[model samples]
Target: MAFTGIPFAALDFYEDLEADNSKVWWNAHKDVYDRSVKAPMAALAAVLEPEFGQAKLFRPYRDVRFSKDKTPYKAHQGAFVARGPSLGYYVQIDPAGLFVAGGFYGATTEGIARFREAVDTEVRGTELEGIVAAMQEAGFDIGGDQLKTKPRGYEADHPRIDLLRHKTLTVSRHFGSPPWLETPDAAVQVRDAWRNMAPLVEWAEQVLQ
Candidate 1:
């Protein structure tokens, strides 16, 4: 399907789902979820596939076996284009708005060790810091899994100690119900953010793998 934009009903669907997360509610509103939410999400991912690769849509069912909250449905829908086993670019939609990001969601102990090693070096470390700065300048918020204290060997005095604290590095931003979200320009917005964050994703792919 050609990309148009996310419909307003998509937002409404999520808004109601947040209140009643039961199967009864879902069955009654199943058509809205399929037509308004899932279709646009698929369309949005489709247009970006040429440059970003195919996106995998997350199943709406929540995995409650390991979680405390037993909510049956997800409040948001997300799609991801992976570059490595655990690193990739992403987009999500919900009642609040659109969220776009790129980076490793999780890292193995060995992968994090390698990331710290890269951050300890002057050339690669500073290069990463520069890319992070540029991403912030372009309006994306930086976040992801992080350590509470300095890693075992890295000193508090280390110049890039902050960067070294990250176990999973990512940049994202929420664009809340913007007007463009209802038009084709929404795809362009996602493209621009993904393109801008390519360096960080590339850096993680190299260091983590």
Candidate 2:
């Protein structure tokens, strides 16, 4: 279903948030995740009108516990909100730092190597690095202070190429938007701030892709 300015209950806001480590949560609330976050993103993609396939969502669980720094899930919720023939825009929902953007990254270790190579070799030398550097200048940190390049050990020739995960500010609350979400730039405005977030209903739809 699409968001038509309907006022959902506050419980709806926390459904996905509360879906931590429980199959029950995943089974019961996966639909909620679709509804609350992915749906609105799809709507935005429609409005922005990308020239490629529909948007899609990555899985939440990352098994990094064996590594030095372990995270239960990614801090940012995202989708391929819009796409051009060559590149795509990822509309990320970071409520703790609620914002959105378009980009690429690898979800696995081998994929991460290509991702790292791309970022270090491709992005850092191009306009994307400027955007990443700008976000850093604005106070957001990458992954964490420890892992700078990208996580390694992903499968080679993976589907997700040049995928780099982003981190929300550590200081922000677990569920609130960051202060910088209101930057005057339209893309930054929609991509970074929660007050003017694209409707969750639409985001829910995009992620289902």
Candidate 3:
């Protein structure tokens, strides 16, 4: 089926789930989830696949083996579009709203080493700084874990100290629960946000390569 849009019921489903996160409640409302939540997400993924590459929807079951909270199902639905193991675009839909993000959320050991090396180089480092600055100016939030102090080998007074301290790098934009979310415009908004972050995504891909 062609992508229409996410219905209001999807958001409503999440809100209800948050209030009653039990198997009984979920089983009763499974149809609502299938029609409103999962179906629309599949459609959204289908629509984005051509440009963003293959879409992979995450399973709703949470791995509670190592965690404290044992919530059976996730409160939100998320998906990623990628060509291979490389990071690409991501999307999330929940009660809060829609979130679109790109870039390496966390890199492999080799990827992290390459990323730091790129930041240590003058030309590539400056280019990354510009990309991040522009993304911030465009209203996207920069995200990732960072070291409180300088990294092991990096000096505290290093020029790209901030970038060098980052363990992972990513950019994301959030849209509050807007009326457009119930319509096809939600996909359009996500697409535009992804497009805006393309330069940063490309930069990361190049550096990691």
Candidate 4:
């Protein structure tokens, strides 16, 4: 099936699941989930695969073995386009809204070191600054965890201090339940958002490579 858009029922499923997150409830409503939520997401992924590369849907089951809150199922459905081994575009649909993001969200130790090195170099560092500025100007949110203090080798007043302190770097944008979300245009919105953030994704890929 061609990708139309996410129906309102998908959001409704998440809202309902948030309240009743139990094995029994989930098993009973599994068909609703498969039809209302997963199918649309799968179709959307299919539509995106041509331009973005192979698409993979995330499992809804949470890995709670290491966590405190042991919710059996995730309240949202997410998927990503795989451009290479490290980073690609991401999409999520949940009760709250839709989110589109890209870049390296969980960089390896080597990846982080490489990224910082790129940021510290004059030419690449200036290029990165401009990319980030363009993303912000386009209204996407810069994301990732950061160190409270300066990283070990970097000076406190480093020119790229803000980018230097980041453990992971990603660009994201959120959309509330807009009218277009209920139509085929939702996929268009996500595609445009990802396109808008492509420079950052490309930069991160090069830095991490």
Specify the highest-lDDT model's number. Answer: 1
> How many residue pairs clash in each candidate at the backbone level?
0, 37, 0, 0
* 1 versus 2: better TM-score goes to: 1
Q: What tens digits encode model 1's per-residue C-alpha lDDT throughout 1-209?
A: 87889998899999999999999999999999999889999999999999999999999999999999998999999999999987999999998989999988898899999999999999999999999999999888999888899999989999998899998899998888989998999999999989999999999988888
lDDT of 2 by residue, 1-209 (tens): 33231113223444445445455555666676566555554554453443434666655666685876453555445656432221244555543334343332223344334434544444232434454445456554333222444445534343332333322111111223433333223333443432122222122123222
lDDT of 3 by residue, 1-209 (tens): 76677887888899999999889999999999989888989989888777777789998778889999988989999999862245788999898878889987777888888889999999999999999999999999998878899888788999899999887788998897888888888889888898988887888888776
Candidate 4 residues 1-39, lDDT tens each? Answer: 777888888888999999999999999999999997899
lDDT of 2 at 69: 45
**What are the Cα lDDT values of the candidates?**
0.93, 0.40, 0.86, 0.88
Which 10-residue window of candidate 2 scores lowest in summed lDDT? Answer: 166-175
What is the lDDT for 19 in model 1? 92
**Global fold similarity of model 1 (TM-score):** 0.97
**Residue 147 alpha-carbon offset, candidate 2, angstroms:** 10
Candidate 4 C-alpha error for residue 118, in Å = 0.5
Q: Give the lDDT ranking, best first.
A: 1, 4, 3, 2
lDDT of 2: 0.40
Best by TM-score: 1
